[model samples]
Target: MKEEIQQQISDALGQLFDAVSKLQLAYPGKPFTPDGRLVGDIGEVIASLNYRITLNEGLTKHHDAVADDGRLVQIKTTFSDHLTFPVHHVPDYYIGIRLQADGSFEEIYNGPGQLIFDQLVNRKPTRTGLHGGLMSMLKRINKDVPDAERIPQR
Candidate 1:
Protein backbone atom coordinates (compact mmCIF):
# COMPACT_ATOMS: atom_id res chain seq x y z
CA MET A 1 0.00 0.00 0.00
CA LYS A 2 2.80 2.40 0.90
CA GLU A 3 4.56 1.56 -2.37
CA GLU A 4 1.39 2.26 -4.31
CA ILE A 5 1.00 5.61 -2.63
CA GLN A 6 4.63 6.47 -3.32
CA GLN A 7 4.20 5.56 -6.96
CA GLN A 8 1.17 7.80 -7.22
CA ILE A 9 3.06 10.68 -5.68
CA SER A 10 5.97 10.11 -8.03
CA ASP A 11 3.68 10.16 -11.05
CA ALA A 12 2.02 13.34 -9.90
CA LEU A 13 5.38 15.02 -9.29
CA GLY A 14 6.60 13.99 -12.73
CA GLN A 15 3.56 15.58 -14.34
CA LEU A 16 4.05 18.74 -12.31
CA PHE A 17 7.70 18.94 -13.36
CA ASP A 18 6.74 18.62 -16.97
CA ALA A 19 4.12 21.33 -16.68
CA VAL A 20 6.54 23.67 -14.91
CA SER A 21 9.20 23.03 -17.49
CA LYS A 22 6.79 23.92 -20.27
CA LEU A 23 5.78 27.07 -18.42
CA GLN A 24 9.41 28.06 -18.00
CA LEU A 25 9.98 27.53 -21.70
CA ALA A 26 6.89 29.50 -22.63
CA TYR A 27 7.96 32.46 -20.54
CA PRO A 28 11.72 32.71 -20.94
CA GLY A 29 12.47 35.83 -18.93
CA LYS A 30 10.08 35.23 -16.03
CA PRO A 31 11.59 33.77 -12.87
CA PHE A 32 9.87 30.92 -11.07
CA THR A 33 10.26 29.36 -7.66
CA PRO A 34 8.85 26.08 -6.45
CA ASP A 35 7.63 27.67 -3.21
CA GLY A 36 5.95 30.65 -4.88
CA ARG A 37 2.61 30.40 -6.65
CA LEU A 38 2.98 26.62 -6.84
CA VAL A 39 2.47 26.33 -3.10
CA GLY A 40 -0.68 28.45 -3.30
CA ASP A 41 -2.05 26.31 -6.13
CA ILE A 42 -1.28 23.12 -4.22
CA GLY A 43 -3.01 24.49 -1.15
CA GLU A 44 -6.12 25.40 -3.08
CA VAL A 45 -6.20 21.99 -4.74
CA ILE A 46 -5.84 20.22 -1.40
CA ALA A 47 -8.54 22.28 0.24
CA SER A 48 -10.88 21.67 -2.70
CA LEU A 49 -10.27 17.92 -2.65
CA ASN A 50 -10.35 17.42 1.11
CA TYR A 51 -13.40 19.55 1.79
CA ARG A 52 -15.17 18.86 -1.54
CA ILE A 53 -15.19 22.55 -2.38
CA THR A 54 -14.90 24.37 -5.72
CA LEU A 55 -11.86 26.55 -6.29
CA ASN A 56 -12.37 29.93 -7.88
CA GLU A 57 -8.76 29.98 -9.15
CA GLY A 58 -8.36 33.17 -11.20
CA LEU A 59 -12.08 33.77 -11.56
CA THR A 60 -12.41 35.60 -8.24
CA LYS A 61 -10.53 38.39 -6.56
CA HIS A 62 -9.36 37.47 -3.04
CA HIS A 63 -11.22 34.26 -2.31
CA ASP A 64 -9.80 30.99 -3.68
CA ALA A 65 -12.77 28.70 -3.30
CA VAL A 66 -16.53 28.62 -2.71
CA ALA A 67 -17.71 26.36 0.07
CA ASP A 68 -20.59 23.87 -0.20
CA ASP A 69 -22.99 26.38 1.32
CA GLY A 70 -21.61 29.26 -0.84
CA ARG A 71 -19.33 30.83 1.73
CA LEU A 72 -16.16 32.41 0.36
CA VAL A 73 -12.88 30.75 1.33
CA GLN A 74 -9.45 32.28 1.26
CA ILE A 75 -6.64 29.73 1.30
CA LYS A 76 -3.18 30.46 2.58
CA THR A 77 -0.37 27.94 2.36
CA THR A 78 3.15 27.95 3.78
CA PHE A 79 6.10 25.66 3.94
CA SER A 80 7.82 26.09 7.31
CA ASP A 81 6.72 29.72 7.57
CA HIS A 82 3.91 31.91 8.88
CA LEU A 83 1.02 33.04 6.72
CA THR A 84 0.83 36.61 5.42
CA PHE A 85 -2.82 37.48 4.95
CA PRO A 86 -3.35 40.08 2.26
CA VAL A 87 -4.94 43.35 3.33
CA HIS A 88 -7.41 43.57 0.46
CA HIS A 89 -10.35 41.35 -0.48
CA VAL A 90 -10.52 39.23 2.65
CA PRO A 91 -12.97 36.36 2.42
CA ASP A 92 -15.57 34.86 4.79
CA TYR A 93 -13.09 32.31 6.18
CA TYR A 94 -9.37 31.50 5.89
CA ILE A 95 -7.95 28.04 5.41
CA GLY A 96 -4.34 27.81 6.55
CA ILE A 97 -2.22 24.88 5.40
CA ARG A 98 1.37 24.21 6.40
CA LEU A 99 3.53 21.88 4.37
CA GLN A 100 5.87 19.86 6.52
CA ALA A 101 9.42 18.80 5.57
CA ASP A 102 8.23 15.21 5.48
CA GLY A 103 5.93 15.83 2.49
CA SER A 104 2.79 15.95 4.62
CA PHE A 105 0.54 18.93 5.30
CA GLU A 106 -1.30 20.21 8.36
CA GLU A 107 -4.35 22.43 8.27
CA ILE A 108 -3.42 24.74 11.09
CA TYR A 109 -6.54 26.88 11.17
CA ASN A 110 -9.94 27.07 9.52
CA GLY A 111 -12.33 29.74 10.76
CA PRO A 112 -13.85 33.17 10.28
CA GLY A 113 -11.99 35.91 8.42
CA GLN A 114 -12.48 38.33 11.28
CA LEU A 115 -10.44 36.12 13.62
CA ILE A 116 -7.43 36.27 11.30
CA PHE A 117 -7.87 39.95 10.50
CA ASP A 118 -8.15 40.82 14.18
CA GLN A 119 -4.90 39.01 14.93
CA LEU A 120 -3.16 40.75 12.04
CA VAL A 121 -4.40 44.12 13.17
CA ASN A 122 -3.23 43.59 16.75
CA ARG A 123 0.23 42.27 15.81
CA LYS A 124 3.22 44.52 16.07
CA PRO A 125 4.72 45.84 12.87
CA THR A 126 8.16 44.64 11.93
CA ARG A 127 10.76 46.00 9.52
CA THR A 128 9.86 43.36 6.99
CA GLY A 129 6.23 42.72 7.92
CA LEU A 130 4.06 41.54 10.84
CA HIS A 131 5.90 40.24 13.89
CA GLY A 132 4.25 36.91 14.75
CA GLY A 133 4.70 33.22 14.14
CA LEU A 134 2.16 30.59 13.12
CA MET A 135 1.76 29.42 16.70
CA SER A 136 1.00 32.91 17.94
CA MET A 137 -1.56 33.49 15.21
CA LEU A 138 -3.10 30.07 15.83
CA LYS A 139 -3.30 30.78 19.56
CA ARG A 140 -5.15 34.03 19.00
CA ILE A 141 -7.46 32.47 16.45
CA ASN A 142 -8.27 29.55 18.74
CA LYS A 143 -8.90 31.86 21.68
CA ASP A 144 -11.03 34.34 19.79
CA VAL A 145 -12.85 31.77 17.68
CA PRO A 146 -13.65 28.74 19.81
CA ASP A 147 -15.15 26.78 16.92
CA ALA A 148 -12.03 26.95 14.71
CA GLU A 149 -10.79 23.55 13.59
CA ARG A 150 -7.16 22.47 13.24
CA ILE A 151 -6.67 19.43 11.07
CA PRO A 152 -4.03 16.88 11.99
CA GLN A 153 -1.02 16.23 9.76
CA ARG A 154 -1.66 13.65 7.08
Candidate 2:
Protein backbone atom coordinates (compact mmCIF):
# COMPACT_ATOMS: atom_id res chain seq x y z
CA MET A 1 0.00 0.00 0.00
CA LYS A 2 2.79 2.38 0.89
CA GLU A 3 4.58 1.59 -2.35
CA GLU A 4 1.41 2.18 -4.34
CA ILE A 5 0.86 5.54 -2.64
CA GLN A 6 4.44 6.54 -3.33
CA GLN A 7 4.05 5.59 -6.98
CA GLN A 8 0.88 7.67 -7.24
CA ILE A 9 2.63 10.61 -5.67
CA SER A 10 5.56 10.27 -8.07
CA ASP A 11 3.25 10.10 -11.08
CA ALA A 12 1.28 13.13 -9.98
CA LEU A 13 4.45 15.14 -9.42
CA GLY A 14 5.80 14.11 -12.82
CA GLN A 15 2.62 15.28 -14.49
CA LEU A 16 2.72 18.61 -12.64
CA PHE A 17 6.36 19.13 -13.60
CA ASP A 18 5.59 18.46 -17.23
CA ALA A 19 2.67 20.90 -17.25
CA VAL A 20 4.74 23.59 -15.53
CA SER A 21 7.57 23.04 -18.00
CA LYS A 22 5.17 23.48 -20.90
CA LEU A 23 3.81 26.65 -19.35
CA GLN A 24 7.36 27.94 -18.93
CA LEU A 25 8.05 27.24 -22.59
CA ALA A 26 4.97 29.21 -23.57
CA TYR A 27 6.44 32.29 -21.91
CA PRO A 28 9.72 32.63 -23.75
CA GLY A 29 12.57 34.51 -22.03
CA LYS A 30 10.96 34.05 -18.65
CA PRO A 31 12.94 31.95 -16.19
CA PHE A 32 10.88 29.50 -14.11
CA THR A 33 12.45 30.26 -10.75
CA PRO A 34 10.78 29.42 -7.45
CA ASP A 35 10.16 33.09 -6.79
CA GLY A 36 9.20 33.90 -10.35
CA ARG A 37 5.88 35.36 -11.43
CA LEU A 38 4.91 32.01 -12.96
CA VAL A 39 4.58 30.56 -9.48
CA GLY A 40 2.18 33.35 -8.65
CA ASP A 41 0.23 32.45 -11.73
CA ILE A 42 -0.02 28.92 -10.46
CA GLY A 43 -1.29 30.25 -7.18
CA GLU A 44 -3.92 32.28 -8.93
CA VAL A 45 -5.03 29.22 -10.82
CA ILE A 46 -5.30 27.30 -7.59
CA ALA A 47 -7.26 30.05 -5.94
CA SER A 48 -9.60 30.32 -8.90
CA LEU A 49 -10.22 26.59 -8.88
CA ASN A 50 -10.75 26.41 -5.15
CA TYR A 51 -13.04 29.41 -4.98
CA ARG A 52 -14.81 28.97 -8.31
CA ILE A 53 -13.75 32.47 -9.28
CA THR A 54 -12.90 33.92 -12.64
CA LEU A 55 -9.44 35.42 -13.08
CA ASN A 56 -8.69 38.67 -14.87
CA GLU A 57 -6.06 37.21 -17.19
CA GLY A 58 -4.75 40.48 -18.59
CA LEU A 59 -3.30 43.36 -16.63
CA THR A 60 -5.71 45.03 -14.27
CA LYS A 61 -5.58 47.73 -11.64
CA HIS A 62 -7.38 45.99 -8.81
CA HIS A 63 -8.68 42.58 -7.73
CA ASP A 64 -7.79 39.29 -9.38
CA ALA A 65 -11.30 37.86 -9.52
CA VAL A 66 -14.97 38.32 -8.85
CA ALA A 67 -16.51 35.76 -6.54
CA ASP A 68 -19.76 33.91 -7.24
CA ASP A 69 -21.58 36.31 -4.99
CA GLY A 70 -20.11 39.34 -6.76
CA ARG A 71 -17.43 40.13 -4.23
CA LEU A 72 -14.05 41.32 -5.54
CA VAL A 73 -11.13 39.14 -4.48
CA GLN A 74 -7.45 39.94 -4.44
CA ILE A 75 -5.27 36.85 -4.40
CA LYS A 76 -1.77 36.79 -3.02
CA THR A 77 0.24 33.60 -3.46
CA THR A 78 3.66 32.67 -2.14
CA PHE A 79 5.84 29.64 -2.75
CA SER A 80 8.52 31.14 -0.55
CA ASP A 81 8.26 31.38 3.24
CA HIS A 82 6.80 34.87 3.37
CA LEU A 83 3.63 36.74 2.42
CA THR A 84 3.40 40.43 1.59
CA PHE A 85 0.09 42.27 1.14
CA PRO A 86 0.33 45.27 -1.12
CA VAL A 87 -1.25 48.52 0.06
CA HIS A 88 -2.29 49.96 -3.25
CA HIS A 89 -5.82 49.00 -4.35
CA VAL A 90 -8.42 47.68 -1.99
CA PRO A 91 -10.61 44.79 -3.02
CA ASP A 92 -13.65 43.35 -1.27
CA TYR A 93 -11.62 40.51 0.18
CA TYR A 94 -8.06 39.18 0.18
CA ILE A 95 -7.12 35.55 -0.32
CA GLY A 96 -3.65 34.48 0.71
CA ILE A 97 -2.54 31.12 -0.65
CA ARG A 98 0.75 29.56 0.44
CA LEU A 99 2.09 26.87 -1.86
CA GLN A 100 4.19 24.33 -0.04
CA ALA A 101 7.16 22.37 -1.42
CA ASP A 102 5.34 19.04 -1.16
CA GLY A 103 2.67 19.83 -3.72
CA SER A 104 0.27 20.95 -1.01
CA PHE A 105 -1.13 24.42 -0.34
CA GLU A 106 -2.57 26.33 2.55
CA GLU A 107 -5.10 29.13 2.42
CA ILE A 108 -3.32 31.16 5.05
CA TYR A 109 -5.93 33.85 5.30
CA ASN A 110 -9.21 34.75 3.61
CA GLY A 111 -10.88 37.75 5.15
CA PRO A 112 -12.39 41.18 4.59
CA GLY A 113 -10.43 43.87 2.75
CA GLN A 114 -11.07 46.51 5.34
CA LEU A 115 -9.76 44.26 8.16
CA ILE A 116 -6.61 43.50 6.24
CA PHE A 117 -6.10 47.14 5.36
CA ASP A 118 -6.57 48.19 8.94
CA GLN A 119 -3.99 45.67 10.05
CA LEU A 120 -1.59 46.81 7.37
CA VAL A 121 -2.09 50.45 8.15
CA ASN A 122 -1.33 49.98 11.83
CA ARG A 123 1.46 47.40 11.50
CA LYS A 124 3.31 48.18 8.28
CA PRO A 125 6.18 50.67 8.29
CA THR A 126 4.56 52.90 5.69
CA ARG A 127 1.40 52.93 3.59
CA THR A 128 3.48 51.49 0.76
CA GLY A 129 5.57 49.06 2.78
CA LEU A 130 4.43 45.43 2.31
CA HIS A 131 2.94 43.59 5.26
CA GLY A 132 4.37 40.43 6.83
CA GLY A 133 3.52 36.78 6.11
CA LEU A 134 0.59 34.51 7.11
CA MET A 135 1.12 34.10 10.83
CA SER A 136 1.98 37.72 11.46
CA MET A 137 -1.06 39.00 9.64
CA LEU A 138 -3.28 36.45 11.33
CA LYS A 139 -1.90 37.47 14.68
CA ARG A 140 -2.64 41.11 14.00
CA ILE A 141 -6.16 40.26 12.84
CA ASN A 142 -6.84 38.19 15.90
CA LYS A 143 -5.57 40.92 18.15
CA ASP A 144 -7.52 43.71 16.54
CA VAL A 145 -10.76 42.02 15.57
CA PRO A 146 -11.47 39.06 17.79
CA ASP A 147 -14.72 38.20 16.01
CA ALA A 148 -13.60 38.40 12.42
CA GLU A 149 -14.21 35.38 10.21
CA ARG A 150 -11.29 33.87 8.33
CA ILE A 151 -12.11 31.52 5.52
CA PRO A 152 -10.51 28.14 6.02
CA GLN A 153 -8.81 25.95 3.44
CA ARG A 154 -11.28 23.75 1.62
41-126 per-residue lDDT for model 1 (tens digits) = 76776666566468884747778887776777888787656676665434587787776433356767777777677667755556
Which segments of model 2 are wrong by more than 4 Å? 1-33, 123-129, 139-154
For residues 52-147, could you state the per-residue lDDT of candidate 2 as single tens digits?
567787756568877766677888877666776765655677777777654457766677777777656656465654666556665456444433
Instruction: State each model's CA lDDT, in order.
Output: 0.65, 0.65
RMSD (CA, Å), candidate 2 to true, equals 7.4
TM for candidate 2 is 0.64
Clashes of each: 0, 0
Clashes of 2: 0
